[model samples]
Target: MASNTSLSSLSILIALLFLTNCQAARHLLEETPEVESPPHPTIPTLPKPELPPVPEEPTIPKVELPPLPVEPTVPKVELPPLPEIPKVELPPKPSIPSIPKVELPPVPSIPKVELPPKP
Candidate 1:
């Protein structure tokens, strides 16, 4: 019961605070007059400074090179012929035996069951 009363008092205090804030806001909105703001000041423009021109690059001289020497030719040597190899005969592979087939018995069927009617 004490907690309930404290909760109720807290809720009432919050409601009163909200109502007072709303009333103050309504008074400010209705009573205050609109005023014009002062214009912004303009800044003066500054002149740009002049710069000196760049100097030209110096020219380079060309150089000449001596000619290369010629290469000498070489003669190829001849080789003797190789001996011929004899032919060889190979044996034939044996055939694999066939496997016999296996037979299995059939599975038995399950019997059906009936339940009694509900009361």
Candidate 2:
């Protein structure tokens, strides 16, 4: 890649030399005047080119499109009447018995437990 870049630069230098030589040759030699000027020749007058006046920009027209038709709606459906459920009459719950109040006996006192001496 580096070699290719250097080669291109060398070729450009050669082309520039050719261009400079051609310019130098034209400067070194001048052709004799075909006719002597009377101090100065009458300057030629040229008519300026006539360009057409720019046309006015056109205006954009707006087009109105009709609104799209509405879609058909499906009627709401009602389910068939639910089958009449038989009245479920559960038997009345048995009445709870009233408990009689009773007094309990006091807990007995335990004698002091003693540990025997180890030999």
Candidate 3:
């Protein structure tokens, strides 16, 4: 059929394209040369600067002060006592009723038919 021939021709064209791509990749890998990378430059080290020493603090003379006077004591005020509250009683909760169980009928069995033997 014409459809079968067209399909075969399409498959052959795809196969040729794949083969050409593979051949080009192989040729590029074989012909390309490896390049060397440049070396990194070295950095110079700098010397640290020295600082001058700090001067010592000057000595100060101490002076004596007079003692403070004693403070007077304060009297505390008495407060009245609070009255007691009365206790309250609550009623008991009601009970829930029980449900009865239900009974189901038995299922019937199906009958089987026997077939004749083939000749």
Candidate 4:
């Protein structure tokens, strides 16, 4: 990826150098004398034609609708009462036994070893 980006940048730099060299090498010709142009004839204006007015649209007739009838009321219905459920008592949970703690013996100390002197 890095090599590709660097190659593209190098190509762009060479192209710009080439274009600048080409533009600098070009030579412009000397200026020529200007000639006067002939005068144009004026044209007479003609009157514009008149257009006819657009026709009016016809109106639609109104329609009458019949009134809607009233709805009848419904009588209320009575339902039977539901029976009550009996409650049950649960047994008590058993207690856990306590464990007794034992004393640990002391650890023995490690003896130190003598080292030789460095040369």
> Across residues 1-119, which tens digit of lDDT does each residue of candidate 4 receive?
56988999999999999998776665322244456889988898888888788778888887777787887988888888888889888899899999889888998999999899999
Between prediction 1 and prediction 4, the one with superior lDDT is: 1
Q: Predictions ranked by TM-score, top down?
A: 1, 3, 4, 2
lDDT of 1 by residue, 12-109 (tens): 99999999999999999999998889998888888888878888888777666767767776777677887888777778878888888787788888
Note the clash tally of each candidate.
0, 0, 0, 0
Q: What TM-score does candidate 1 reach?
A: 0.40
Per-residue alpha-carbon lDDT of model 2 for 1-119, expressed as tens digits? 56988999999999999999998887766553456557766799999999999999999998999999999999999989999999999999999999998888998999999999998
Candidate 2, residue 41: CA error in Å? 82
Model 1, total clashes: 0
Candidate 4's C-alpha runs over 4 A off are: 1-79
Index of the highest-TM-score prediction: 1
| Top candidate when judged by lDDT against the true structure | 2
TM value for model 4: 0.30
lDDT of candidate model 4 versus the reference: 0.81
Which pairs, if any, clash in model 4?
A: none
RMSD of each: 10.9, 30.8, 8.9, 13.5
At residue 58, candidate 4 shows an lDDT of 84
